[model samples]
Target: MRAKDVTGIIGEEIAAEYLSRQGHEILERRWRGARGELDLITRDGAQLVAVEVKTRRGSGYGHPFEAITGPKLARLHRLLLEYCAAVHRLHERRRVDVVAVVLSGTSEAHAAEHLIRGVEHLKDVS
Candidate 1:
């Protein structure tokens, strides 16, 4: 796979781990619907959450959260609805969330040294 794809996968995994530590039960990862894909599906108590994960090696380009645009959020909202319909959870409480992950290192040689620069979770984003 491409490096970008690898980065995304790693980011999603990290986001999942982080959420799990925060007491969220992960329901799905990379869930695709007719509209788009959700990076992670989790349950926070009685509420269902759809998470969008954005990862970046560095902030030279922009922060990971900066990638989530207005149109993107709208698409995520539609995808969440589609997911709910598919899982027969239309009556459950749901909300959209974003998890931004930033890594500190850039080279494969320094992979072991690479650390998570930050993890920012925004709830009810849409």
Candidate 2:
């Protein structure tokens, strides 16, 4: 796979582990619906969470969370609704979340080191 694709996969995996350590039960990863895909689906107590993950090697463009614009969030909300219907959980409490994964190192050559600069989780984003 391309470096970008690999970065995303690694980020999602890291995000999942981080969330799990934080007491969130992961229900799904890379869930695709008619609308689009949700990076992660997790349960935080009684509420269902739909996570959108953004990963980057550096913040030259901007913080990873900045990538999630208003339109992207709207699409995520629609995807969340579709997911609820698919799983027959329309009545359950739900919320949107964002997981920003920033990796250390300036180039792909250092990917072998596999260092994480940070992982930020934003809950109830929508």
Candidate 3:
């Protein structure tokens, strides 16, 4: 796999671990539909959450969370609805969350030093 893809996989893994620690039950990973993909789908109590994972090597372009644009958010919302309908899961409350994972540096040493240097969880993001 490409380095970018590997980075994303690592990011998702880290995000999943973080969410699990936060008491969120992971329902799915890399949930795909006609619209697009949701990195993680989780159940937090009675609320169903659709999570988007953004991974970055550094801040050369921007923060990992900055990659989530208005259109991208809209697509994620649509995907969530589609996923709900397909699974026949009725959720009284639903939300969109973002898991931003930033690595320490671009060098291999940095990558080996810390898989994820920082992680930010933004809940109920629109």
Off by over 4 Å in 3: 108-113
Q: Find the 10 residues in a row with the least total lDDT in model 1.
A: 105-114
Q: What are the lDDT scores of the predictions, listed in order? A: 0.90, 0.91, 0.87
* Candidate 2 whole-model C-alpha lDDT, 0 to 1: 0.91
Best by TM-score: 2
* Clash number for candidate 3: 0
What TM-score does model 2 achieve against the real structure? 0.95
Candidate 1's displacement at residue 64, Å, is 0.9
Instruction: Score candidate 1 by TM-score against the native.
Output: 0.94
TM-score of each: 0.94, 0.95, 0.91
Q: Candidate 1: misplaced stretches above 4 Å?
A: 108-113
Ranking of models by TM-score: 2, 1, 3
Candidate 1 residue pairs in backbone clash = none
* lDDT tens digits by residue: candidate 1, 23-114: 99999999988777899999999999999999888888698888989999998888998999999999999999999999987764444456
lDDT of 3 by residue, 1-126 (tens): 677787788899999999999999999999989878899999998888999999888888698878889999998888889999889875557899999999877764334455567999999998
